[model samples]
Target chain A: MKRNDFDFSQPNKQSYAAIVFLAYHFFRILVRQLWPVLIAVLVGRENLKNMLFWIIAGISVLVFVFAVISYLRYYFYIDNDELVVVKGIFKRSRTNIPFQRIQTINIEQSILHQLLQVAKLEVDTAGSKGTEFSFSALSMAKAEALRQVVLEQKSKILPLPQTSGVEKISGSELALQTILHLSFSELIRIGATQNHLRSLLIILAFFMTLYNQVEDIGVDTDQVVDQINEEVVYFGKIAIIILGLMSVLASFTFSLIRTIIRYYDFTLFRTNDGFKIVSGLFTKKQISAKDHKIQYISWADNPLKRLLGLYDVYLKQASSSEVRDTKSISIPGCNSKNVERIKFYYVSPEEWKDLKNFKISGKYIYVRVLYFGILPAIILGSLMLFTDFKIYSLLTALWPLLVYLAFRVNHKKWNFAINHELIYIRNGIFGNYFKALRLYKIQSMALRQSIYQRKHQLATITIYTASGNINIPYVHLDLAKDICNFVLFKIESDKRKWM
Target chain B: MEFLNEQIDVKGLPDITDIQAEKLAANYLKVIFITRGLTSFIFITGIVVAAILLKDISVTIRFSVAGLLIILFIWFFSLSSKVFNTRSYAIRQRDIIYTRGLLFKSTTIVPFNRIQHAEIVSGPIDRFYNLSSLKIFTAGGSQSDLSLPGLLSSDAARIKSFIISKTAQDEEE
Candidate 1:
């Protein structure tokens, strides 16, 4: 069918007007700051001659407000196999989305949506870079019903089962599964090692942005810098001590918030169609995977988690999002107890036996430490400290030394389960995680060796799944080859679509 | 479709074959000549105009910038030529192999079944030379996708159609 042939209508917003308003205001606030940015760039100072900057800023703000009004006025609909998006102030574009190619439809409601009783719909298709259709605000009930109807229509042509084959497992079993996987102490550790350095960098960047904004308004940045400098001298010793304490507190706070938001009373349940994952404390997120679409399962334990015996579990599916892959659930704090529960819950009991049989040896850990841990640390550290221009000179020496030792300890804790039915691997520090996947689901497998690895007779096996690749690093070359060959054999033998 | 053995048929996989570099080299040079002619013209004009207008700027900085441009031009030329000459793809009975690298050699193979689509693209220069580029898309990410430049237009078309037919037949089964 042609792109425009299908009839499209905007989904009715059952009663989410307030939520829409909230989202609108959020966007408006962001747009309001654009002028301050542009003026800062053009004038190179806060104040400009003839009040031109303010005039320009005022005009721009009016234009932005008009744009927001136009956007808020927009609505859309889908009917008779076509998606219709009605948007624009003067001229409207009623974009049509065909039902034939749609792969999946999901309804997501943020906290605002939940409070307002509205949800957003995301429609995805195979091979498409972005969603084919999206509705910002719709009634929750209508969204689900519409999603089902569209999904059913799409499934008729796409060849997947129309009905989700969710198996209903006992709530007690689910609670057991949750208990088996969740570890309170391990959660704290995972939060601690969450690579907050990136977040810290982002915070620093935000502070710089605020500083720039202040400067743009014609404030003397030199004055602010001087003020900071004066403060440092006025209370130099106290400032240093306070900074140290503040840094520690900030790190812990970051960890605590992340844990509370991500894993807060997370639970996994078995439904006829697939496994249902319910997580998040403030605004719960429920995700389900078709039994057939799951590509991999992984869990890992970070250094702290390892010390506390914690494990984080993740299910990698064919469809992925930023948070889906990143935010994993604590299967039950750092331990082997929940491993069996996870295997049996997702995989068959027979598969569970096979999973248990597969082992991770000490040799693998030693090789991982020698190559992945020590060697890279030394090289990176030396390179950073002894570089030609001496950038990151001090950080290079101190950071790597600490990182190397930490990684070494973490690598020694690495473990994997390679059975006839599934391949599971667990690694990571503070952010402990475990991933498991059916052998048949692996789309591709590769055995790679760097020149250095080759010299040491070490190889890294990367098993490709739909979500991403999972690597078992620094295994003996012989073991790597064997696993690679076995994976290839399994992948080829299975008639299931790994794609 | 069923298991031939309880293992991957490693014996069936093809070994890497050396591809002819002349076609690639010729295309690379033509592209380089066109790009250099346009960019150098722009750069020279910019330098002359800027030198005349910006009297406060030192002559040394301008000359140094010009030198930097020359170095960049040489680097781009060398890099492109090396990449063009080294990159070549081969097709086996069941899979297509692409070999490329200036420093670290990489050979990637995609089986016929895995190919999502194949396209034949001919630019103005390529049309002039009766050559086209063939891109083989797979379900995998961009890195695993294969591109073969500087093929005879007819050959590229023939291969494209062949792959399409093969894929259609497999899917129908």
Candidate 2:
């Protein structure tokens, strides 16, 4: 299905619309580099104006020229089952990616691209570092056609077993079977329930940066602080309450806007090979992963999400060491039934039924409290006794109660299980999290014993996978050994591909 | 799959601690001492120079610096020997285990199937002593999971080739 409109026989440059894309990137870098000076200028730093203005203008001109040259120089073509990319203006660099090595071809469309009816294509390889190659701007039709060709070539190279029986359908038909979509109300709920502490930190960081910049421009921050303190004293408790409410409102609004922009029109579709997720508003993104490539499935729900009956499910795949986070796709707003359906798709019901649950030793609670509670309390208490901060010692007294609560949570949450095919772990600090992975997917296993653990005949077993590490701590040494051996046996004997 | 229902005998399973580990080369201790001596010499020289330049500096400060240096020297010497004695590595049919550390000992086991690559590297001092270090990398992280230093160059090369072959065999299966 080669398009006659765009010649595939020779190396092809991205559409001229790519110049706009390049210019935007160049402008972003320029703005980031010159932001301090720009802020200084805005703050009425008169002496530096002429110099800064000339410097910024010169850089902008250079960036524009470079963007044009880069757009002109970049070209790509497929030759003998390899995608060859020739780029760079002054120093030419060529990258050849074989079809078998291409892990995912992601098509993204920024607001500018949408306006121009073009798409950006990012090709990711199994390499651990970053995106292998990205074509900044291509016609929407051409980008989709190239994606199809690359995928077809990749299938020919690897020959996926599960794709054999499903009947091939056109692209339009394939996009129709959406597995999940987030409603506006669901998005609002997610936004409202976001971690407020994280957003507060971000807001604090922004103000801190601005304060630093103002100080650099010779503004007397001490005077400003004095004025603010006097105002606070004058306004008293009402001022404090108003400020708190305003900050909360600001954080909530920020979260809401972020959620709307990120999850707008989010959709997941099932294809013959695997699943495809399309999301984002300003910059649309499409990510697809095959069924067999999924290494594990996990879901987590905090107290707020639990109240809203929402669960965020993550499907992890074998990823490179550097970009492990990018390989997993998280689907928010999944109900219990949806979670079970996805679990069933990855693991058979028979295998799931065979799982034998095991709880960690009760001593784990004592150990955690000793390490995370009493140790800190001792240091703080000793500091208070030695120093003038005697009043602060009262905080140390509260550690025992905190430690008891932590112990209770630890004892309740730490559970693991193993079936014939998969291992399941349930853990979390303040929320419930569940992870399940096939035994064969584990790359390595280690049975470790600390001095205390050794004395108590307890061991910690760590299973390493490409995506992350799973630790089952404070289990009987004999049980840990048996589990380690069984995992190793399964890994060695299983003939199926782990990825 | 049939083994899923069967009771696994924990005693019958292979234990990493049971493996007879081979100690690093004797010359490795000499390399460690030389490096430590170089560092100590530089540190002592710096203190002496500072004392000489600041003549008005208190005698108490000089004496305390000397005392601290002595204590550090004793601690380093004692711990170095203990660490050297404790370091050992064992290569099994399916995995390699390296155990080290004197006070808080740790043993890292990396299976053949998990190893991304293996390399033999020799620093200037290692080259002088005809020794090399074998580094085994995995997809787990940026750093090599296991690095066994102070092996004769030939031994390192032989181990590297063996690991490479095992990795190839694992990949084929």
Candidate 3:
């Protein structure tokens, strides 16, 4: 269908498919709300049968009526260059978003929407807390037409140079220029390399939930624990080893399944304007941010990922105050060459090569040791003098060694650099993290000195960007001041757009 | 990269310490004393009420607690006075600099172009004294990056207008 076929001037309701979507959502919510009653019916099956039937029937009818009412009440259209949405059942709200203020119009299609050939449209405005307006379901044709009209109006206001001819290209032709694609094996590698501790904790939490549910069903947990203890004693040390190995295997499998589901058919494509990443098995998320909007780019590789030659690259864009994780696009399973390619797009290749590195002051090591080691040691030693935890006193003896190791690793990892308009900060111990941002993108800068730092003539400089703030902690006061001045000078002089 | 290779003359650059910032309003000290005095009065009243409620408590213990609170309040007032004296702000052509704190000193520089908005607000006590506070916000975060309290209402309005105009001009560029 042609884009001009839709009558955008008149106020209109969404496609009838929206009612189906709303009904599905409302039904899900109703089920969640009635979960306690459902559990009661499950426990007292014979006695509550009639009550449960009536309750389900009443809730289903109420949810259906509510969803239909909500669908009927919602209406949106473009009026006087503003996207106006009038919606509500009782209170009634009219949201008028000026075309010039719209930051982005995101279109998403869930499985149900895809089946119905409908899309969910979300309009985001700059300076607002979150999504300004959301239409749960709209016809695909109308969604595209609305997006084009909004973009046209935005271009009229901003006068941004159009990166034309992108729409004409077919999907297959665009796929030919795929920059990064994670194969099944690579996804497996990423899953296996994930931090085992986090996966173990997730597994533990899952079991804890089950344990709680069992307790709620009147099971004696103490009896279960006593039986488990008897089994453990009968089986002895090998039983503990077997259990540990089994838990480790369970975590690994869980992580593998999660990665498979999340990153299935992960693909990144470089377009004329910027990069496009399409991933997710069920949700099918498509994220595209222009190159200019990108404020920072960072990549990290843990020891396991390093062995497999894999790193996760993150592109952080200028975001509103919400701080949603969606502001950044993370592409895992990227090799070193892919990382270089991605960096080349954001930063100039020559500038990337000539970054002048500087190490943080060694005093950071002393401070870290004092806080992480000596203080803990003192607390534990004092506690041992009062409490009967002699084992904790023995653990106190290990603090000095821990402090030494931490200081060595911290000193080795902490470093930052500058080159032309770009500032590079690299830190982290087991995982090597590298972040780079343009100096002009910094919104503000601060130099902080604690009493201890003041005595040592050391200070910490923090540079705030739209995505997040970066800190160069425990640097020589003189050097920090010089860097701050240079950064401010660059920010004041540069005429380029920050986002 | 060429810019990094070039040497930056640290000595030639304007140092925050050397900028010679202007102090807050002359009555700022008086304002602080009044506010602190009011707070301490409330705190002492609460303690006295508690002591009266607990009839079994000895008079000596109650008197000692009161004495300790008074001493602590005096010490806090002196420390706050020192901190107030250290508070200062400087306005450059392109940015505003604010420095505060007696122990953990911090110097914040927010460029004019980066400011999202500026507001001039006066509280009851500040209004009584004809003083106002200028708050400068940035898109970098939710909190205002620079908030300078204890300015004469007129000066606060002037600064607020200047910042608003600067922000508008920056947007144009």
Off by over 4 Å in 1: A1-30, A33-83, A99-104, A110-115, A124-126, A130-133, A161-199, A262-265, A319-339, A349-434, A437-465, A470-493, B1-88, B122-128
lDDT for every model? 0.60, 0.79, 0.81
Candidate DockQ values, in order, are 0.11, 0.34, 0.45
TM accuracy, model 3: 0.88
Ranking by DockQ: 3, 2, 1
By summed lDDT, the worst window of 10 consecutive residues in model 3 chain A runs over A164-173
What are the runs in model 3 whose C-alpha is more than 4 Å off? A37-47, A161-176, A203-243, A324-326, B1-11, B36-75
Q: How good is the docking of model 1, as DockQ? A: 0.11
Question: What does the lDDT read for residue B84 in candidate 1?
Answer: 67
Residue pairs with backbone overlap in model 3: none
* Top-down TM-score ranking: 2, 3, 1
Best by DockQ: 3
lDDT of 1 by residue, A1-499 (tens): 2122222354433334534554465456665866676556666554556567676667556666655665565665667766556666667766666776564565666787777777777766544544355666667766666666566555554565322223343211132223333346545666775656665666678789999878768889998799988998999899989977887777677767877677765666655545666666666665555555555666665555566565556665664332233223334343566655665656767555545323333445455455565677667767766667466554545654565566665565577777666776666554656667777665445555565566677666666555666777777766665666565555544445553
Which digits, one per residue and each the tens of the lDDT, describe model 1 over residues B1-173?
22132323443422333333234536545765666566766776776677667768788887777677766665655576666666666665555656666554444555566677888888887788788888987654554457877787888888898888876765665
Question: Model 3's lDDT to the true fold?
Answer: 0.81
